[model samples]
Target chain A: MAYYGTNGYGDDAMDTESSGPKVTVREVESGRCDFVLQNCPLALANSLRRVMLAEIPTIAIDLVEVESNSSVLPDEFLAHRLGLIPLNSMNVASGLQYTRECGNCDDHCEQCSVTLRLHVKCSSPENLLVFAKDLIMVDGRTDDIGKPVIRDSAGNGPLLAKLRNGQELKLSCIAKKGIAKEHAKWAPSAAIGFEYDPNNKLRHVDYWYEVDAKDEWPVNQKNAEWESEETAADFTFNPDAQPSAFFFDLEATGVLEPDEIVHQGVDVLQKKLAEIINGLTRSDEGMNGGMSPDGYEPAPAEDDYAYGRGGTTPYGATAYGQNGYGGY
Target chain B: MSNSAERDTEMANGEAEEDSADEQELLLGGLEKLVILPGQTSHAASFQIEQEDHTLGNSLRYFINKNPDVEFCGYTIPHPSETKMHIRIQTWEDTPTTAFDALRKGLEDMIEACDVVTEKFTDARDGFEASKQ
Candidate 1:
């Protein structure tokens, strides 16, 4: 949750010595974010990406009830399409749980789910483009409830299905919170990845000024130099830069904001790690005399007096090793 | 065994054992080999695994890609419909053992998280059912 200064590189920059993560948001809008992570390892960055992409839960159409369908697409095919449509998942942070996980006994309840009904009967001779806007949220929310869930970045209502004259489709879809591990529809982000950050520094301003307008610079000729001294020289090819830092870019599926996705990703990762630690700790404790339910149990050692060759001699006799089968 | 540990943890976490769940045999078998990659300061490994689908492959890639020591990590399914997944991992600035340790740790963490979710839901369900009485 901490924000680092915009200075990407400096001798006395944010303390890399400290374990605290240095997060600098380069750009953040509704569903897109570019951020720089200093003092973060590749693993942590990758974990954040993984969590944001798949682990972070989002609402999606899980179940569809079709009342009627006479379109070219079968009822199952139409339901499948509806299920793939992403829904706004910001409600997850607002104390909403998955329908199955919720306290509600009803399969379809408002507290854990949202319902969208689509009924399109094309009467015109021309083909009708049934946009996402056509699927009205029937749970008493505004008409625009499903509008933000569209995968199109432009927020335009995506065409759900095409209907010919006299063709109709009637269905109710239930949106529930689930992870992308279960299905791609629940993935919060369309893409999440990071690259190593090269911490570059400008050593000599004069060197850059001399190289300006000359094709000597390694980078693109157009981006070689600033027009004036006031403008900063391009450090596109700095050989010296910190290798540990990473630049991360995440594009959301409009289910959650990009910054929120990162926060949620980190939160979910921490909880997951904590759970693992707890399980390991419990297992370690169970090693001490705890009855392992359905686990391995060593067989008790057999007494030798009853079955050994020494039994033929005497109860207290020690068997000699003279015979091949004899033993102590 | 790790399987015993997983089962115990799942039971403690109130995970309902679904009879039809896909076996993690492919992942476990691949991990058992611990194939070491050549020409890396830190131990690196590349291996292929055949499973029923790409779910485990994608999950493993996502899990392993998060290690700081993992210099390069990528996976290819080879074909769109093929179940065989090839994963290549290169690690530097840390021991190859660290990468393996992280993989084991990541899988355990995922299992544990599922347990927690199952427990939470079970508790909520029990309370709801009790209230109905």
Candidate 2:
């Protein structure tokens, strides 16, 4: 009867948001309903489940990124392709393209550039190669398309991406399924990034130089010091030439902390549960009692009218028998 | 017998006769058959009485509408050719027993109101007939 859709990307910076690529879909009907979600974070999916269970009839969910950066395969199709796994699996750390370079500015030149690093540590040698190969392939594709690439001079490889010890591959694809047809379809409709300044101070400058001196230097001293001015001059001061404390202020905007984001998702789910319970309770109350008119008194209970031997008659028993129950 | 005694006796007899007439009129005008059909449930209830009146339809509607919980799904009124009045009520699945009971009470009230109207109309008609005579 009612339909609702929330686009997670309404916030302009989708790329930088803690939760990436999210979509929600809800459908309701007279007797039953279905929900399809996709590309949403796990915490979000769980929260949506609670909201839906309150009133929806049937729900089917597909969590795409349970193993982060994994391919976005349709759940039904995947289930048929691969047998169901009873045990939970950990996310595999994959390579992310950090930088790339080529000589021609076009991707064809060997002299142009070479570098590739991964964000995650490979579990094994084979995994390292596999991850490296994947990153190279991705870089090649991006270079061919003329996209800007981050180049790593340290790693002489043609393509450079990073892989932290626990950093896993975060693939760009649908992370969930269920009511996700519009936004979390087979692919993400768009990619967005978020950035902010936490301190709110406008000072982002790196260097400051100041020169101070007395208005009139001793006249004789000045002339004498002219030749030795370099050694005796108090006019100029260079505060340590070392670079100002290397500082970077990158604040989170629309970027939820991992835990906070998870909690937000769960809250949506809880509200849905309450709605379902309330709907059921209301239906039961209307069935039994007929409408009672305003100011009407309830009739006496049947038990109250019953006398000693049997239930009270319309008139006295003696009068009823003698007159054969004549008219009132 | 003394005059006052005689007068009292006469008044008592007259009162008895008037009571009998009123009873006869009420019996003739009362509901002939009442049927209440609840929504979705297959079974319908039927009550037999002595006469038919338009009050049955109005009362049924009033009863269902009065209850906040009773969500009327639909209703059907019999064709003019049908002899007895039939009323159908459909209530929301969530309605409580108290609300349903209230609806039943509303129906009874409607019926009583109808009886009073019918009795007044009958009385006026009788007066006109007597005057013509």
Candidate 3:
């Protein structure tokens, strides 16, 4: 009779067996410290600060068309009162003296004058009143209802009353006109149009991997991975499971250095030594020679040692056949 | 033939009326916030405010004046202390995020654009400081 016998410790049973060398899995949360150098232009920084501290003004004005008999102000007259002028009619004050020689005899060169050219085309003429005002009402205001609008009312225009939109109009009456100082300055011409979410985390994780053993070993061959895997399986296969031997390295976070781990490693020191030797060699060669074979030279000998005799002679004693100049 | 011609004429009249109505609406909308700054003949004037303080009113004035699209009108307001003035900007919109960002950036650029002016002003101020010293 043929009997079917099953091996109690079969290959399949062994494969499913959990028995193995227990691993002390440790989870290490570490970080690497890196430096970011940001250099802000001094001029830009000062400008930003200045702007932040300065009072910014807002100006606004409006123009409305009124009926001919509406007793409304005329655009030409208003332009004249507000110091707005046509491009062709701009004239610099003659009495003003320029330290820099004025090339334009008319006292109205581009350098000293401003040109305002406005052309409005309307299909139909109605009661049109130009209303203007600077929104930023600081200290300046119109003192009177009727101010003389300074503008060129020469072309296709009828006699009309005009006034500037704002009362406190600041004109360039200083040393120079048409210069940048006469004009208002604005910062950044364009805006960054992108949206930003502050809560977003950085995509890259900053970490420093280190081997616990002092001796150099293959990283892939380390038992830590297997031990960690086994420990993780035992702990319900949770990927976030911390191993018993693994730990966090908090010193590597931001500006802090991993002094404990770094000091323990000799690679950096060795690299620094190599760099110093290279630097010294470069400096020495550069100072003495242009990398020429004859660049190096021996130090000079001492003059007294080279000239003096090795044997000692009696004080004031003369040589043989010579009179003893120092004899008692 | 007369009936067809009458129908065409009516359609034309309706189209004209519609166009006129649209134009009137546009004119009224534009006029509501209109501002006119009359300046002297042969001279150009511009008004501006800081980006932070810019409003629809100021933006309307800028639009009416036809100021340079790229270059902001130059204007500044005296600080509350009255010791110094800051540059202002006028824009067409009033969203704080956009306005502040523009203003901050514009201020930075203005410093560069007006470098010579800034330097001169600084030197003049420095001279005054030295005299006091």
Better of 1 and 2 by lDDT: 1
Pairs that collide, model 1:
A43-B66, A43-B67, A43-B68, A199-A242, B37-B44, B43-B96
Candidate 2 docking band:
incorrect
lDDT score, candidate 1, position A74: 89
For each candidate, the DockQ is 0.04, 0.01, 0.01
TM-scores for every candidate against the unseen true structure: 0.52, 0.17, 0.17
Per-residue CA lDDT of model 3 for B1-133, tens digit only, reads 1012223444667743223222211211111111112221112222221111222222222322232222343434335322112333343443333322333333333333233333333343345446655
lDDT of each: 0.51, 0.26, 0.23
For residues A3-82, could you state the per-residue lDDT of candidate 2 as single tens digits?
Answer: 11111222222123353332221222222222222222222232233222221111111222223533333434443221
Best by lDDT: 1
* TM-score, structure 1 vs. true: 0.52
Off by over 4 Å in 2: A1-328, B1-32, B35-53, B73-76, B98-103, B109-133
Please give, for residues A116-197, the per-residue lDDT of candidate 1 as tens digits: 8888899999998787767778777432333336655655465778999999988888776667755677788998656542
DockQ value for model 3:
0.01
